[model samples]
Target chain A: MSERALVIERLNKIFTTPNERVVALREIDLQVKQGEFITVIGPSGCGKSTLLKIVAGLDVEYDGKVELNGQQIKGPSLEKGFIFQEPRLFPWLTVEKNIAGDQSLKDPKVRGKVHELIRLVKLEGFEKAYPKELSGGMAQRVSIARALLRKPDILLLDEPFGALDAFTRSHMQEVLLNIWETNKTTMIFVTHDLDEAVFLGQRVVIMNPRPGHIKSVLPIELSFPRKRSSLAFQEMRRTVLNEFEKVEEESYTVGAGI
Target chain B: MTVEISEKLSEPQKKKINWLNVTYPWIVPIVIVIAWQLVGSLGFVEEHILPTPSKILTTFGTLLGNGELFYHLTVSGQRVLLGFALGVGVGVLLGVMTGFSRLAQEVIDPSLQMLRTVPLLALIPLFILWFGVGEFGKVFMISIGAFFPVYVNFFLGIRLVDQKLIEVSEILQFSFWGKLTKVIIPSALPNILLGIRLALGTSWLVLVVGEMMGTSAGIGYMIQDARAYAQTDIVFVGLVMFALLGKCSDSLVYAIERKSLKWRDTFKG
Candidate 1:
């Protein structure tokens, strides 16, 4: 709905554990244009989660600024919706209730919008079901529906389908792509899956290990409805894999550590 | 793919349950009662001191005809109901506060913990001295017994709410009270119900002990009065009534738990 959707300026994050001080993110700079779909891929503990947290406003102790449509993020707000790795549905609520949980849905029109989001995520008949009855992928689908119901400018996803099996994971990726195409919301997804990054992201940002910072940004020029078997897609994957290998060789942290 | 087909196939069927869930419980209780009757008939024990099932039932019928049993039952039930309601209500309110706020938890948790250390029955003399061996004293003891389990459960339930759900609530701009009522309370529900169950049991027990020393009515008083008249069958009736009431209340709570968590049972393995 607005131009220049999100901008992250030189973000820095440090974690103080009881016995150790670990740098989670350092000097991160990024820009996500309106309707842009950006996926981040790296080794585990590369501060991908930390970056998403900073954008989602869950962690504010970091340095630098995160803005959505020129407004600075003071804390977590309805302007940006987050889908965590775990579905995290309240066990007491039904699936429909879970998806419609955000405060903005207090509006009657927003209630109608939640039904649309549920259909978008392909959970049309599951409104009455509970999270416990659903499989891992199904619960995560409800979570995505929940996030989209807020109608945020940007959708921040931290590997929403990471816990699912491979086939379920692929199906979810397609669902995610379909949602992106229809809504055109700027989505910043953090994942460790290289193939996932190549398939869904318009541009894939690769980060080096902890005290994580972006090492390279690889543009995925392949068009949507991207065929996994396409030679162009395969070639792009090969190139990205080569670059990732290089970063892994030079990584300094355990996850990104060479 | 194999998964593509199954993904659309709906949920997998769970294994069939065994007969133990229903028939065996009923059978075991019946067998135990029959054996006790047989043993008593065979002169295995003195009938006057240890009344048989039939003798107890006969005494129960006589007591019922005289309204003696109903009077004690009514008195004990009233105390349990009052104490249980008061204890659970206060425990839940305090528990919610402690769970949500560090400062409140810091102030109240220590005193509540200390209060739990003093056995509730031990306070009978103090209660009599304060309230003059009356209905208030009996109700107070039951309330004390119910408080701890309810409080502990409420506290644990609140603490156990998933951190990510809280994050979701925060991002949505839910106010503190909104989060407490909508998110935190619902998330903590299963555990809270568990606390209520434990408190119910504790309250039942305290009702018996509370009436044992201080009251002239209730099952405890009935048993004490029967002892004076050597009406061992009447005492047996009181014991049987206590057992039945306790059993029925626990079963009621269990049923409630099942009804509330029905969705969970279907969804989870």
Candidate 2:
């Protein structure tokens, strides 16, 4: 019913070396609606991150089409925000400055926006603290705030909480959900964690490696603030897990045959 | 009970340790000065060969009172400051140019590296011949000396900027100038500061050589003039001035380093 925010059709990516050419992704077609939250999950070497990178226009050497709102993706733009696995906060910049980033903090509007984002990320007291001074989780939160400051059309997160501890990772997930609810921006989250996939995504895209492609898309009919302990939540998670395991077993067997 | 007693004893001992930490660096220099004074006063060494510490102190007082020392210090300071400024400006410009452009790096870097290999003092005769034995020649020599360290460090710094950060800049849609000022320069600041420190040290060294050759003013000139009159105490005073000034300049840069690089999570020790 909603307008399409992104359309990826017959997308393929290849990495070539002097020795060999490897297929990173193949025939990856997906459609995302405006304000939709999609989680892509797969095993290692799945090229899920590569897919996100392609969509962000950081990797332009791909076949087929990735159109964002009817325009072909050419290169990285302010409209597409990307959060890498690492926090990657500029060490010299304070929390406020990192969020403000290239935008002059001298402007009252910019300062207010940075402050609001900081508060949104629950980093209220760390405006003056440099990246090195903040904890790992705090640094990542600053990065999230920084990405949100640009008010991008779509935010692609590549396992942004992969390095965090279980507790912090869960907390960050909630924080991310809160940001998504407030902004209502389209999000395509890539993760290896099944719990994360089932928890955050309106739809979970299960990917298979060895010429990575989408195996299936499972839409969650569950409500917001879905409990991990709930029977319905467990059933959905189990279904995605089964799909994920099937791909893994198939890839393993294929490798063995090779 | 024994633990409590040990803790009570350690409290005063901790205070003593703090006092020792403050005084530790000065102890050796003070002891050496005292011994040197003792030897000089006993006439163990000829005054002409090695003047007494008290005699050197007296010369220092005379130089200070007559304002000659201040004048010479000012001359040397001016030359170093001017030359260092010129050197830093040119070095940073070239460094930035070569850093951002591969074409610039390829065209300029190899030639610069070749030039850097030559001992800069060897250029003094050529400088004298080209610019004459004027203040220009001396300043030129000091500037050349200051240039290489800065150029090398800044170039290396720029090249060493993290690739991930560059991607972040790209993602932010930073304009060329924005990327340079916001990302590149700030990332390379530690190296640039290091280059500055090295350049400052080299500037002083070149200043001594420069003044010793042609200049009739400055601490180096004062030393040369004293040598002619066999005023060994005055020579010692010049040496002392050089030492003090060098240390002072180094400390200034160190203070800048401390202030600017507070964000670095480096080992304190």
Candidate 3:
């Protein structure tokens, strides 16, 4: 068995307003192994993004424990790379400079690494292009390259392709799978797309809202480059969809009783 | 065959368009000048009341020939440079401090805002009493005029930096200095540049008012002296010089802005 990269034990998160305390996550427990790809799929208000934020140490105000390699998660570090929905590329910086970030590009090693990541993300001949000059898809690719520049222990993506069009979204999914194959870095992707969850994740963790807890974990027993139109792919997608349907029916019944 | 012919014709056509682009801005000013010269030549207005373009040009030429214009220009230019530097330096420093530290903003911003509202011209009497019509008093007045715009814009720019980018900085584990230099400053650059342009114009206005009172070597002094002698042509010459210098400074800052803010995707029109 691969060593555990991240462990969450009875994690609970609440957001307090002036009038009320909202439970964003409840009794959530999951473990991610090193080099494993985990996709968390949930509807809006499911707290999947909140869960990722906590793990990334952007939100440390949570109950229970989130340990990365036996160390309690405290605050953001270079070890945990985060990719938000938007590319978040610095407008002033060129593609190469954005990847290099605060690290001086005058160093040959840093320059070489930036070039390598640029190629890895397939942004050739665009090293000098600013964020404004690039397309939405290209900007997001640059963002992915930036996240991988530090060679982080884990990368957390919060619906990184949610803003992209359907065609670009699928293309980006394939690109992400290629990066995962090459780097073998642990990734925890949070998305609402069923096809995306099944297409990339080795294990899909389905989540439900209204208190926000994991409904079930479905392991995808499939090979790489899984065809979207194939029977098995459709079957797995249907299973995940059925999980959501069951949750909806139960919630409706509870509503009727009330 | 048609494509080749069109390409050959477009060569001169492109040049014509470029020429028009360069000359269009001068059309209105040139027309006004010609009409004014016609009016003067036809005796529609006295030269003392409204000096003819030809009369102003001759006066300008005499001043240039004797090196008087150059000397006055240099004197006023030097004062503007010193005062502008002092104002911009202090404004940016305090702006950055208040931008980063909430406590500094709380302690200093209200006082600065109150001072900003105070009429700068009304302080001339107080400045004269304190610094006594010397170089210091004029420079101080100019500096005070240049300070407020830069300070306000820079403070607002820093405050308006995108919170998302700040989160990106946190994730990258940027140090305080790193965040300020890499994220904060670059993001605030557009507003800062705008502030600088406004401050430059204010500096010139204040310089004219300052020179009108105190020292007797600047362009403003020359105009005041011309007024005393009823030499309207020399006064027109001084006014023209001010207009030319203001336009030149504005163009310089505009070029800097274009170079620095090339990354902004905005509507050019």
Candidate 4:
């Protein structure tokens, strides 16, 4: 359980256009032990999504290296699953078929796994429904199920429930925590929400933007089935919020170079 | 629900509903027909130039009784169907090819665009010269007319499929064929169906013009033949048949679209 599952060393990324170049990430270093739940909290341009993309092997045009299970990631593989802010479910396919994806699970035994996933996601009754027929939360659940179908060692989610309503977003966070507890898959969840970071992550990586670097790593000591109304939860959230403000002020001052 | 709504209506509202649902549609046709009948009976208009509705109906009955109308209709219908099938097949195939391959688009798109811009009806002269007054000539003309709309619509449909959906396919590690069949085609289907609907109309229009040249047994020929003898009633009957056929084929395409797109959560009411 203590074995390192992912390693990122001095990761840097830049977006080059015809007229100018914008640095998106700079000197981002991260490490994750097996089955660890890590949340990345940052402002909009803090490169949280970019960091996740690099780890998922979706963006390979970076300066540093990313390794999963001691092997360098060259491109996307079934070993790691990636989920975007949008569900991105195929509208033309039924819910079950969308989760089944390319139907690469040709083994008759593997077909049953889709049903298991449907049950796991608590979407058993709506397996035949299309994406458009689903509510926002249900659709994101389908996206989660699709990413989990291959049983990836690591799941990279970029603001998966960001588009959901406040109630649905909190509910989905608890659902995600339950899944993480049961599946024991390493998860790197990225979000801009302070409470979500404190509530979900074993360690929340607070990031500040300008060039995008990690500012602090805060470990949450709360137990599972955590109550949001509890004093400890409020304290944790306040602590994270205060750290967030300090980082923002520091970045503002540093950016102004005064 | 209907009873409650009806009960709520005032006298004026009731009258409005009656006018809108039952009486409004018939007003224009009734006025036109009565005016036409009066003009014909009073000799205010020449019979040869403007036949009354009754005269047209009488010509329609005569044509139906003699089986001439059915023969011409079936001939025209056959040409439209054959040309429509060939055009749709070729258009969809090329659309998929160009959509999936940059090389195919680079090589084929320019020529297709140039061909599409030339008025399809204007090519009737060239078609007659090449195919020489045969069934093939008319069918070929109809095929050309049907092809461009389907090709252009499908190509755009394929292009407009959301990028996020394709990214999911990449993350899933789908093979090239898997992406094409599962993601590409299904996503592009609504537009493809629209293309087919549009193609059907073009097929009917081109079939009429194609039949005008070197054809003896079609609705287009019937209208042309009647024009020489000033049989205005027969020409009216031919025009009616064209409208009916066009409507029937359009409904057929709509039915297909409804069946294939049942998964869509579009507005039903």
Candidate 5:
């Protein structure tokens, strides 16, 4: 259970813009335990998404070492699944086909697995629907389902519910929590919502904006089906929110009068 | 419950709801034909110059019965098919090369741009002189006419393949052939269809001119030959046959395009 799922060492990302060198990430180190749910909370432009993309191997032009399952991550593999903010479903495919997208899972048994996950995500009966026909929340569910379809060991979600409504977001969070419980897939979710971070994470990591680094990592110490109104849950949310605010202020001072 | 409501509805009611599908295309053509016929019958023009629906039908049948019409029609049809195939084949090959390599793109793009600028029909005299007034000259003319559109489309289609989609393929480590077959071609199909449509129309135009001015066979030749003998009705029949052939070929491409894009067009509403 204590086996490391991922290790990020001395990560730095500098983009050579037309006029100046922009630092997106700086000297960041992160480690994840097997089957742990880690939520990264930060203000927008805090490079939380950039960190996730780097780990996903979607962006490799960074000074970093991201290792998963005892091997260095160089590019995306079936072991790691990525869910974007938008569904980004291939418009030419139906939900069922999208979930089965470009996978080697040709076994008829795998299809049964897809149908089960479809129900787990509460996307049953809409399997044949196109992405455009689905609501924002529904489409995001399909994205999650598609991510899970590969049976990935590590699932990296970049604010998958950010565009969804409050009710829908809560429902999807619940669905995600349930799936994590059953499958024990290592998840690293990036979001700006502190409550969401507290709601989903076994540990909440707050990142600072501009030259983004982990400001703090707070353990939730809560059980599954976490009560939104519980005192511990509220306290975890408050502590993370304070850390996020302090990081924002600190970044402002450093970036002042530039 | 909403899913139940949507699913439980009868197919007939679904059809009724999408009545536009049933009526629009069918109705528009009928209306246009009726209007054209009524105008012609109501003394809009002399019968010898402009035939009504009934006169046109009689002309169509007589031309078919005489077997003179098909002799010319086949020649134009064969020319279009042969040239169009060659043009599209070369275009796709060149387009793929241009799209994949920066060095190839620089070399090919300049050449393609210059070649596309040349009017294919203007090369008719040159084609006749180079290849002689046989089938090769006309086939070459039609091929050149079809080549440019398909090349441009195939090239642009390769370049515009969504970068994200390519990333997905790369992430999966698809084999070279697998990526080309599964990702590139499907993504490029719509643009490729557009090119095919344009190229076919251009081929028809080129074939007609080639056959009319320089040959003794084809619907164009029939028209020109009729003109020489002052056979106005035969000339009109040839013109009508040209229109029909053009419509039929265009519809064939369009029908296949619809079938291919059925899933994509589902979002049109």
Candidate 6:
């Protein structure tokens, strides 16, 4: 694995809706060393999704450059796997077909990899079930296997488990951590859940609401498989919580003066 | 929460349905048949104008014994099968081209939209003028009737494919053709199947009218022939045959739709 897998520098994004020009992101700069798990947490309209889109090369209209493995992101490529909030699995396809859908993966060698991925996601005995028949968590597991099929260098996820119930959400977090440990692939996840952000990120980047940009980047020194209730984990969570309150108070004061 | 609520609500639905409700659809037909039989036995109307049920049954028996009924059925079946095949083939091909290409849609859609507004039944004289008093005119009429529904449904189905699914395919770097085969077509199948069902019904509708115009050796022609001779019993037999055939064909298409969409978990309500 390469050392510097992803770099975003001086990134800016403005969405031009019919009625208004919305500044979605402003002067955002972030760096992820290879195999790092970074979580982005912000309020609504904080441009977290836009940031992931830029990194995935889904939106190139943004101002700054995003480089992956020394190559400037131009457009969507198979190298960076993306998972949306919804599972986004083709409803018409069965579980196995959805994961092994790429024509190149039809080869017997790559097909074996698909089976391995199915097992990795714990979707055994569901090889032939359609999307409608599976539960939401089960469907998302298939989506994860689909992204991992190409062995992408980086995985960008946008609120992937936000729609799931609490039990499913916690289980999915554990499953994701296990997959990350096994693959050691660089992952950047965007979520609004504070506990989720702290639980998943090796480094948590908190962004402010208006003119969305990173307000702070806090690094967690705790070792792998960190307990959520541990002193170090709780300390990190409180630190992230304090930054949110500080930003909220500053915004409130500025609004009152104006 | 939604799943839990739906599961609770589903419990009563899973219980055995009422026996009366199970047999509900057949009730009206049975009542109507019994009423007709009573009217015939009571001599409520003249035998010629309102043929008795027994008279109609006897007519059916004779027609079957002499093989006349089979001949007319074979002729009508052949026309419908040929016209339906030709119409569906052309419609699907054009539908795919228009759906896949903006240029094709620009050149084709407006013209098709105009044609669709013109009642196809009113084109009988025009067809007769072109291919007069022959099998060609009758078959052409049936084909025209079948074409519009198929074309309209296929175009709409292809265009209305979910954007989210397309985006996923895009992220996977699917080729244009790959997207069409795997994502677009499969998603569009429900609408396409609806179009086929509508097209088949139209085929039957136009078949009767087509055979009634300048034709011989069909159920429609036999009805017309019986009316001219004032053979009301034979006319009744012809009408009943048409009803049975139409029901059979529609049920066949319905079975196909059920088989193809077995994966879907539609709400019973």
By the TM-score metric, which is better: model 4 or model 5?
A: 5
Q: How far is candidate 3 from the true structure (C-alpha RMSD, Å)?
A: 4.3
For model 3, the superposed segments whose C-alpha errors exceed 4 Å read A252-258, B1-17
Summarize candidate 3's per-residue lDDT along B161-191 as a digit string, tens digits.
9999999989998888888878998999999
TM per model? 0.89, 0.93, 0.94, 0.86, 0.91, 0.89
DockQ of each: 0.44, 0.32, 0.44, 0.36, 0.37, 0.36
> What are the runs in model 1 whose C-alpha is more than 4 Å off?
A16-23, A102-111, A252-258, B1-22, B40-46, B175-178, B265-269
Candidate 6 per-residue lDDT over residues B6-43, each given as its tens digit? 46544554778799986898899888878887898898
In model 2, the clashing pairs are none
Which prediction has more favorable DockQ, 3 or 4?
A: 3
TM-score, cand. 1? 0.89
Of the two candidates 1 and 2, the one with more favorable lDDT, higher being better, is 2
lDDT of each: 0.85, 0.91, 0.91, 0.87, 0.83, 0.87
Candidate 1 lDDT tens digits, B29-88: 899889989888899988877878998888889889999889889988999999999999
Quote fnat for model 4: 0.56
Candidate 3 interface RMSD, angstroms, 1 decimal: 8.4
Q: How accurately is candidate 6 docked according to DockQ?
A: 0.36
Candidate 2 chain A, which ten residues in sequence have the lowest lDDT sum? A124-133
Off by over 4 Å in 4: A104-111, A256-258, B1-67, B262-269
Model 4 Cα lDDT, one tens digit per residue, A1-258:
999999989888999999988788989888999999999998878889888988888888999878999999888999899888999898888888888888845667556988888888877667667787788999999999999998999999999988999999998998898889989999999998888888899899999887889998999898888888999999999999999999888878887333
Give the per-residue lDDT digits (tens) of candidate 1, residues A122-146.
8776766777768899899898888
Query: Which CAPRI tier for candidate 3?
Result: acceptable
lDDT of 5 by residue, B78-162 (tens): 8889999999999889988888888999998998799778877777777777987788888888888888999999889889888
